[model samples]
Target: MNRENVLVIGGAAGIGKQIVLDFAGRGKKVAVADINKKALDQLINESGRPNDIFSFEVDVSNWESVQNMMTKVKETLNSIDIFVYSAGITKQVSFLNIDWASWKKTIAVNLHGLFFSTKAVLPLMKNKNGGSIIIIGSGSAITGSGGGIHYAASKGGAFGFMRSLVGELGKEGININVIAPRVIESDMLDRLYPSEGSKNTLKKEIPIGRLGKPSDISNLTNFLSNEESAYIHGQIIIADGGRTFRPKSG
Candidate 1:
């Protein structure tokens, strides 16, 4: 099989890092973009085929930085066949208690970063005729999760972004999709459910009786970024192990 050149933003830790390694292992040349230089270097060093993985330090929240990084990645890899937006942040605070500064910072990283990164790479993917773009979203987008209202709002905005992009770019032959997952055992989960009680309550709510794993998301993302998912576009596919199917208790 011919290998594709894939670009993953935030491909340094957690779910993003898993996706980067998965693609690289499959023989794809991966361009990893992240703000953490140390993590990026760690990923490169850990990848047995160092030549298959290129690292770029970038702040996806900044349009200029994203633009420049995309340019550099394109130059290094020649063309990008798959682009994944996995860079995001969250502030677990009561909706009313969140200050303006914290709210802005959350929005900047979660929503604005997705916008900037997607826009930066659209042209490059379009130039290659057609390519896949998968965005990592959260189940908060559809649920009333406490202490992460801003995060939910940002994820909801991403849904709107993906739906609109489908109409605008699907005809252009670009495959766009969003992968939303429930509480995964990542750094984000550690911050959101700090206490054992909080995590226990969440586990009880999920029908599957377990938290999500990075591979749960990476596997689906891998499929969505392939030609097999060509007919699957403009959809928000949830990979929460049937957690969101539970009914609310009175």
Candidate 2:
């Protein structure tokens, strides 16, 4: 069996890291592109699959950086079968408190990064047997909750960007989808619920009774990247243990 070649952007830490390790564990040749050189080194050195997992430094928000990374990917992996865009940052602030820098940074990494990555990878994917392009999005896009205004706006922009790509890419055999995971035991969750009491309270709101494990997301991501989810494209699947709800926001 020929293992798939996976390129996970922002895959050095958190949920992205989990996806990288999961694919590597499955014997797939995985390449992780991240801006954090420190985390990338730690991930590869500590992952116990150093040879199977390749690392590249990239600023997803920079088109030149993304293009350079793609060049490295093509040279190393030869071709990409799975392209996962998991790059994002969050800053919790009231709409009034939002600053231009914060909003711009959020949009650059979370939203514009998508434009850079998918645009760079499409040529590679289009030449192949129709690969899967998965974006690790946030449920905040739907509920307007958790993350601040800028975070919500960025994710919402990703939704719009992805929706536009579906029609253009789907017929070309490239499957595009967004996985919006919430309350996962990740750095993002840690940022949202820093204290144990807060986390516990948040957990109580979930129908599943606990915070989600990264594996929960990795399992679904693995499915989406494979043949099993071929028909599931151009959709944002929220995996939050049914935790999202609001009674008219009043």
23-79: candidate 2 lDDT, tens digit per residue = 999999999999999999999998999889999999988999999999999999898
RMSD of each candidate relative to the true structure:
1.8, 2.0
Score each candidate by Cα lDDT.
Answer: 0.87, 0.89
- Score candidate 1 by TM-score against the native: 0.94
Cα error of candidate 1 at position 119, Å: 1.2
Q: Which stretches of candidate 2 lie over 4 Å from their true place?
A: 1-3, 245-250
- Across residues 97-138, which tens digit of lDDT does each residue of candidate 1 receive? 988888788788889999999888877777676788999988
Q: What lDDT score is found at residue 229 in candidate 2?
A: 80
Candidate 1 lowest-lDDT run of ten: 144-153
Residue 192 displacement in candidate 1 (angstroms) = 1.2
